[model samples]
Target: MNLLRTLAAISSMTMVSRITGLLRDTLFARAFGASPYTDAFYIAFRLPNLLRRLFGEGAFSQAFVPILAEYKNQKGEEATRSLVDHVATTLVWATVVVSVLGIVAAPLILMGIASGLDGDGFDKGVVMTRLMFPYIACMSFVVLAGAVLNTWREFKIPAFTPVLWNLSSIFFSLFLVQYFEVPIYSMAVAVMVGGVAQVAIQIPALKRIGMLPRLSFNPLSGLKDPGVRRILKKMGPAVFAVSAAQISLLINTNYASNMGGGAVSVLQYADRLMEFPTGILGVALGTILLPSLSKANADGDIGEYSALLDWGLRLTFLLALPAAVGLAALSTPLIAALFNYGEFNAANVAAATAPLMSYAAGLLGIILVKILAPAFYARQDIRTPVRIAIGVLIATQAMNLVFVQMLGMGVAGLALSIGLGACLNALFLYTGLRRRSIYTPHAGWLGFFLKVVVAVVLMGLAAWFSQAQLDWAGLRSHPVLRIVALLAIIALSAIVYFAVLFALGFRPRDFMRRAK
Candidate 1:
């Protein structure tokens, strides 16, 4: 598929998922607020999410997809199918053992991560963490299956799988909150169900594609498979690289947990908002480009690979730049519109807005890393990124300690630390790419970037004026009016930015053209 068309498909589905996720968080904030229970719940929820990013989606998908694509390209479909079955069986057995251990040792894990919570709150956190721990095992398998489908160019099912999680969470949060009383724990149950549903939804798609992986205990089969072994080798370091990022966030969360009752929830909500754009634009581009880059590399078409990388980077920056600007400009209004209801008060909105703005600062960096890291992974040079990622992780922890303890900046400090780390990671990766001459932008790229920056600035100004008008009109008191105003600001910003870019020598048709 063409890059723009693929991105459109992925982004449309991801946008729906993100919107539903926002609704899920909206219900969660109203029902649970930022109480100790909610704090504990976020910690518990983050554990599975961390594992999903580290082992399942982030590392495994990055490592698996390129290799699987190459296998299909080289040895035909049946050989790739065998490799998938072997990897699937091996992954299932390993995940089952890990899940058992996780359930058994939940308290120790919870205490280690969230030792700040006391009394029944601490106990409940452990209980919730344990209840949701099995989700990691289940979702990891789902992600593996999804990776297989993505390798086969079946992106729709995998992209839509997250919708199940969001919808399930929203349903349970709305209905079960009143009946269950402990809505946070109820959400945990919903998460487990969602994970199962996420996996189940992909089965028919896989079967229809005639590539449903079967069970196979032959370790030698996978280990001996060149494609599988190649991915395994790359995965070892890529896991560390992915874990470095997640571990940094985990450290931030741990610090945020100790800050206050609501700090964790504030960070969580702000992060959810930031992830909306990142998932829709950055992740969609990365997912599409990985296979394309891999195919280019496999064919020794370095020019095509570089063109794809440059195009991906340009599109990522174009999309994420305005999102970051808008978020930073309208953090308070956006937070209030989405979250200022039920138990979520104005003070809570203020707390969340600060971190949202801080995260917005590194939005480009975040998306750049998402774009660039795949370039390295597509080249099967995962170790270099891992090395750089370790440095980034250490820097993140140090910055967090300095910001949180020395400066007393709370969750916003943690957000700043993450942003700083992402900036450093992107710079290091870009520098490495330059050293290898693997990626070089065209001369006109700088002019394109400048035009984008100008356009984003115009969008920011428009959004600011719109937000000020809404505030002056006192619409913030009415949730419906406030939400409508925020959506309008978003819509206007997008329209103005695109119009400015198109007027400033950026052709919409040029973006639609195929890479190289």
Candidate 2:
């Protein structure tokens, strides 16, 4: 498979979803603004989303895909299909049980997670959480189907499925806000709708591939399958590793909740913005590279596997480094331009900017980790990453306590702690890869990375100057003008970065050729 082509396709789809998500968030900020209600909604939303990442998307896919791929390779199609059916059935039942418990214990969970939210905020958060908890079950199934499709080399549907989620959220935030009476609660409804849509979108593709898994209560069928058992066993440790990072996020939210109304919302908005690029580049790379790496490892093609790993790392750094710099440089202007409307006030803008900058600083590390973790998982080495992730989580929490409580940095502190932990995690993963002889940096990687850094520095300076010029020209006074100015700056930075990279021996054609 052409890694670059796969990344391109995934990136294009993700860009659409990211833009739609931005529109949804914009509508959210306009309607709800940075208030206790908004904060409560964010807190309620975070729990399910965090779980989705940790369990449904992260650990489940990491552990399940390699084993699934191995089954497809070693056993016949019938055997692989049987394993899918059993695993899907079992996972759905498990998620349903867990979702029910979560709904019933919503209040207790909210209170534990955000003990500082007082009065109406706390009450509303619990209500909203209960309403949205079913999303965990819906998305868990969707993710399972997605993993199956991805392992089958049918990437487009799963990659495009997220558009449904973003569109549903945007529609609710826009059209349903007035009808629902309780506007914030409508967003929760949108989430459940989105989850259903996400699952629905994948069914036809599963049918087209003739791999639509039938739901059954017969757990014994796939339970005895070696691949299924192997995936399940590795899944335990993978969950622990991924949960470490997610737990840090929960801890950060707990601290943010105590900072009064809108803190959680502010942090969430900043995170969404940061996620735009990461999802487009980091996730696209990881998703595409995983099956490729798994296939190579399965065939004992270590050389090809190592080459893909190197390419994945370079692509991540090349794409994410400039994004981090550009975002950090233009955080406030971008936030103000996109969100300074309706109920979203200047204070909200101010609050969101600092944390966005902090997140931007760690953007490369975060994306690198995302790209590298699949390498370990592809080789079925889950426990090492899990152990490292646990260590990182502990360090992150310790830093969060010092920064949030002792240093009094609030959301920015939380962002800093996460960024710091990501840096540590990425370094550890790279070191482990080196020790295992799974990956070694190509001879040109250092020079290429240095060139990227130089290009990013140039881009950052250009963006900063462009922002200053726009400000001096009073462009920011008008929303349209501010948006236009922001776009112009972004365009200029991208051009400069690409041009400089090309001139510095970075070959676009070579990258594109590799994709072919």
Candidate 3:
């Protein structure tokens, strides 16, 4: 398989989903505004989403894929299919139990997670949480299905499946909100609808690939396989390791809940902006590289493993640097164009810009974790990453205490701490890889790093200069003008960024194919 081609396909589809997500956020900002209702909805949606990352995307897939790949490679089709059927059967039962319990425990969970919220915010969040809890069950099946397809190299449909989540949320936020007296309930229902839609869309893909598990009530079927035990063992540590980002989010949410009034929403908007490039670069690379790296590890080919990691790292650096720089520089305009309408005003945009820049400052670090953590995971070394995650979490809380509570930095403080922590997480992983000799540079990394830095510098200069050309008045005064200006700035920065890299002896073709 062409690794670059695979990355491109996944990233492109993910990009579409992220775009729709942005539109959904825009509508959310316009409809819900920065109120207790908005905060409640975010809190409601986030709890299940956190576990989604933990169980679905973060832990389950990481453990399942490496083992699944090993099974397919070492065993025959019968063995591989049997493992899938049993695991699928087991996961379905577990998901149902978790969803029912989560729904029943909604109010208690709300109090536990978002304790600062009180009265209406607290009550409303409990209602919304129950409405959205079943989504966890739906998406659990969705991601398990997705992991199966992804392991089989059926990347597109699974990657594009997230479009359902965004589309349903947007439809509800835009159209259905008006019908509901309390708009957030509609949004919660949309979450459930979208989850079902996402799972439904991917069902046929599994059949097409002949990998779909025939769901059965044989709860103990998975216990018959040693691979299931191996996956569960890995999952224990992998959950915390892969969920470092979401942990940071929960921490931030706890603090932001105390801050009162729109702080959470502002931070979220900034995160949404940061996620655009991340979806394209970090997510794209990480998802594609894991299976490849696992195969390489299974073959005991250290050279191929290192080479795949190297390729992913360089590509991440190439993309993440300019994105980080561009986002930090252009935060104001981007926020203004997409979100500075309806209830989102100048003050909201200004508030969001700080966190946006703060988050952008750590974009490379945040994305690097995505890039590097998989190397540990593919090799089934989950404990090292878990240790790193623990250290980073402590560092994050200390910084949060200083930045948010002591220094009074407010929402931006949470953003800054997250960025700094991400840097530490990536650094720890890099050093660990070196010490273990799990990954070594293929050659030309310093040159590649320097070249990307130079390009990003030029790009940043161009972005800074271009922003000077547009005042706050012209950028935000009219919707059409704001859209045009933001696009122009983005295009100009991208051109300069790529042009500089191209002129400095960097070729796009080189990145598309790994160094031989």
Candidate 4:
């Protein structure tokens, strides 16, 4: 496979997903703004989202995919299909139990995460949490199908299916708000609908691949499958790895909740902005690399395995650095143009900008984590990342103490802590890979770094100049002009970045590689 072309395909589909997600956030900000109610809803949404990451795409995918790949590569078609069916049955049963428990324990969970929430906010959070709890089940199934599809090298469907969820949320944010007694409940409704839509869209694709899982009616039916046992054993550490990261987020949300009414909402706004590049670049590369990496490992081809990691790292820096620079340099305009409307005003935009810049500061590190960690996961070495994650969790909380409590940087401190921790995590993962001699840097890295640095510096300057040309929040009455100006600034900055790279002897083909 041409990895560059495959990466582009997945990234393009992911870009569409991110674009719609931004639109959904934009609409949400306009309709709701930053409020206790919005905070309530965000807090409510975080649990199911945490589960989606933990059980769906995070731990489960890390553990399941490589094993599924092994089944396909070593055990042949019938065995691989059997593995899928058993895994599907096991995952469904597990998801159902977690969903029921989450629903029943909604209030306790809310209190555990956001103890500082007001009585009314707490009540609303509980209701929304209950409403969205089952979303985990839908998303679990979605991720299960997505993993199967990605392992089959059918990347388009998995990448495109997320757009369905974003559209569902956008629809609810647009048309359903007025019907709810508490308008934020509409978002909870959107989550469930979107989850189902995501799952529904992948069914035919799975069938076409002949990997459609025939789920057992009885939960115990798949418990004894050898492949399922292997997955479960791997998931033990994988769960801890994902859980450690979620615990840090839970701690941050708790801190944000106590900070004030709008704290969680603003951090969420900044996070949505950060997700744009991470999804397009980090997620796109990670999604494609894992299956390929696992294939190399399964074939016992050490050279191909190391080369794949090198390719992903080089591509990550090539793309992620400029994105980070653009975000930091144009934080105000980006936040203002996209979110400063109706309920979300100048102050909210300003509030969100600090965290966005902090997030941008570590954007490369954040994305690097995506690239480097998969080196271990593809080898089915989940323990290494889990240990690193646990240690990073501890270090992050320590930084939070100094940055948030001691320094009183508030939401920005929380974000900065996470960013720096990600850098620390990525650094450790890199050192581990080097120590194990799993990855060796290819020649021309020095030249590549220099070219990227010069190009990124130029792009950053362009972004700075563009942001200075607009009173982003002041032009709220001229929404069309504000949006057009933002788009032009982004376009011109991108042109300057890529143009500089081309002049510096960087070409698309220089970075392209074949997986086989």
Candidate 5:
């Protein structure tokens, strides 16, 4: 597959999801404000999200995709289909049990993570927790279906399915807020609805691809499948590897819960802002790279594997660097434009901007982790990344403690600490890859790095100048102008970044255009 082409499809679709997500969050902020109620909902929502990341996106996708690819390549269609059936059967049973147990234990889980929530906040969280529990179970099938589609190189539908998620959430959160006594409860309904839609939207695509598994209830059926066994074996360490960042977020949220009103919401808003470019570039690239890398490794073509890694890294830095710079420079305006409305006012915007900038600082680092960790997983070297991730997690939490507890830096501190820790994690992963000679710097890297950095500097200067010129505070009440101004600035900076790079001879065709 054409990496850039596939990436563009995923990125564009993710961009839609991100845009709709902004609308959802904007509505959320207006409806709930930066209060304990919002915090309670976020914590409640996070319980299933934490598991979704662990089992669905993070560990399961990482562990599942490569194995699926291998089965498709090594075994015939019938065998791979059987393997899929077995895996699907296993996940269906497992997700059901976990969701049931989680629903029953909602209060205990809420208490364990959210000790700082008062009685009402705790009760709200418990309720939403139970409501959102089914989402994880639904998404487990969604993840498995997505992996099968991806293995068949059916990337577009899987990518587009998130649009359903965002749209479902956006519609319910915006329209249904009035009906609920606690408005955020409507959002919990949206979460489950979106989960169902996410799975539903992919079914036709899976059918078209002819890779959809027939549902089987025999859990022990997969127990004897070697592919399933390998997946289960890898999933243990992969969980730790993938769960590390989620673990950090869980810790940060726990810490923020004690920091008084709106603290967690501030962090979530900043994170949402950061995720825009991240989902587009880092996630898009990793999603494109992994299957190809796995195929290369399975074919025992180390050169192709190395080359693909090199391409992914170069593409990552080129995009991630300027994205980080532009985002950090325009952090305040962007936050103001997207979220400063109704109950989410200037104070909330100000509260979120610092952390957004902090998050932007680690943009490249976070993307690097996305790209580099898959390098290990595609090769079935899961333990190394897990160790690296655990160390990074500890360091991040340590920094969080010092910044939030010792220095009392609050949200920005936590954000900065995580950003810095991401850099460290990326560095260690890159260094490990190089030391092992798994990935060597391709020729012209120095020139590529210099040119990209120079372009980023130019983009950064333009963004800073534009931010200084805009009167965001005055424009806040004029929502239309405020949004227009923010978009104008974003357009100008993006133009500058790309135009400068193009002027300096950077071409998309270089890394992406495959040898025909």
Candidate 6:
């Protein structure tokens, strides 16, 4: 398979998901704005959302996919099918128990995560947490299904499934707000409905591959399977690695909650804008790389393994640098164009811009971590990342203390700390790879870096000038004009970036590679 084509396909699907997600966030901003109540909903949603990443996508996928690929590579189809059945059964049992515990302990969970909430805000958070807790089970199933599909090289379904969730939320936020006394509760309900939709679509896709997992009647049935045992053992470290990041986020949320009423919401809004590039590049590349890396490792082809890592890193720098430049240069206009409707006002746009700019600073590093982490995971070595993650977690908090407390940067400081931590995490992971001689940088990197830096500088200047021509705040009354102007600026900036790359002797064929 052509890796570039596969990455493009997955990225196209993910682009659709991100667009719909932006629409959903825009609706929320317009409907509820940034307030203590919206803060309650965002914070409450963060728990199940956190679990969705922690268990479903992050650790579980990291542990599960490489092993699944190994089984496919070494074992026969029947053995692979059996492994799937057992793993699915185990995941179902574990998620069910976790969901129950989360529902029952919702109040305590909210208290621990966002202790600054008080009275009705805290009460609403608890209730919303309980209502959305079971969404984890649904997403766990969805991710398990996705892992199977991805291992089979069926990337479209997994990449596109997120759009269902986004659409579900958009529909609810648009039409169902009036049904509830507290409209924000509708978002919680939407989360559950979206989860179900995501899981439902995975069924036919799994059936097409004839890898549909026949779950066992008894939850303990998969415990004796050696493959399941190995995956579980690997998961021990994977969970810790993922949790380290999540814990930092939780701490940030707690800090934001204590800062003021709309602090969490402001951060959430900035995060939503950041997700556009991250989902398209970071997630898309990571999803495509891991299984291929696993195959190369399984075949014991050191050259192929190193080549794959080099290709991913080069693509990351080529694309991510431009995206980060665009985000930083056009932060205010981007925020104003997408939001600044209904309940989202000039103040909200202004509040979100700094954090967005801060996030943009580390955008390339964040995407690099997505590329770099999978190198370790594909080798079935989760321990190194866990160790690095633990250190980064501690360092992130230290930076948080300095940026948020000592410097008094508020929410923007919280974002900056996370950004810097990601850069540090990526650096450590790269050094580990090099120290072990696992990945040797291919020739021409210096020239490539210089070209990209030059291109990004040109693109950033064009974007800055175009964005400055418009008063984004004043254009709030003309939403169409504002959105059109923003899109035009983005398009022009992208043109300039690619044109410069072309003039610098870069070509699409130069980066293309096939993975077997």
Best by lDDT: 6
User: Residue 409 in candidate 1 has what lDDT?
Assistant: 83
Better of 1 and 6 by lDDT: 6
| Residue range 400-437, candidate 1, lDDT tens digits | 87988899888998998888799899999999998999
TM-score of each: 0.96, 0.97, 0.97, 0.99, 0.98, 0.99
Residue-level lDDT of model 2, residues 75-144, one tens digit each, is: 8799888888878877787788878898999999998899778898888898899888888888888888
Q: Which model is ahead, 3 or 4, in terms of TM-score? A: 4
TM-score for candidate 1, please give it.
Answer: 0.96
Least accurate stretch of 10 residues (summed lDDT) in model 5?
507-516
lDDT of 6 by residue, 1-516 (tens): 999999999999999999999999999899988999999998998988888888888899999999999999999799999999999999988998999999999999999999899889999999999999999899999999999999989999999999998999999988888999988899999999999999899999999999988999899999889999999998878876755656787789999999888899989888888878988999999998999999999999999999999999999999998998898899999888887899899998999999999899878878888889999999999999999999999999999999999999999999888888888889999999999999999999999999999999999999999999889999988999989899999999999999999999999999999997
Residue-level lDDT tens digits of model 3 in 1-516: 888888888998999999999999999888777777788888888889998889898999888988998998899788888888888887788878888999999999998888788899889999999898888888888888988888888889988999998999998887788898777899899988999999899889988988888777777778777878888899988888888878989979988888887777888889889989988888878888888888889999999899888888888888899999999989888888888778887888888999999999899998999889989989989899999998898899999999988999999999999999999999999999999999998888888898888889989999988886776534555789778878898999999988888888887678765422
> What would you estimate as the lDDT of candidate 6?
0.91
Q: Relative to the unseen true structure, what is the C-alpha lDDT of residue 443 in candidate 4, on a scale of 0 to 100?
A: 91
Instruction: Using TM-score, rank the candidates from best to worst.
Output: 6, 4, 5, 3, 2, 1
Off by over 4 Å in 6: none
For residues 146-169, could you state the per-residue lDDT of candidate 4 as single tens digits? 899998899999999989888998
Q: In candidate 6, which residue pairs clash?
A: none
lDDT of each: 0.84, 0.85, 0.87, 0.90, 0.86, 0.91
lDDT of predicted model 1? 0.84
Candidate 2 segments exceeding 4 Å error? 218-224, 471-477, 513-516
Q: Which candidate would rank higher by lDDT, 2 or 5? A: 5
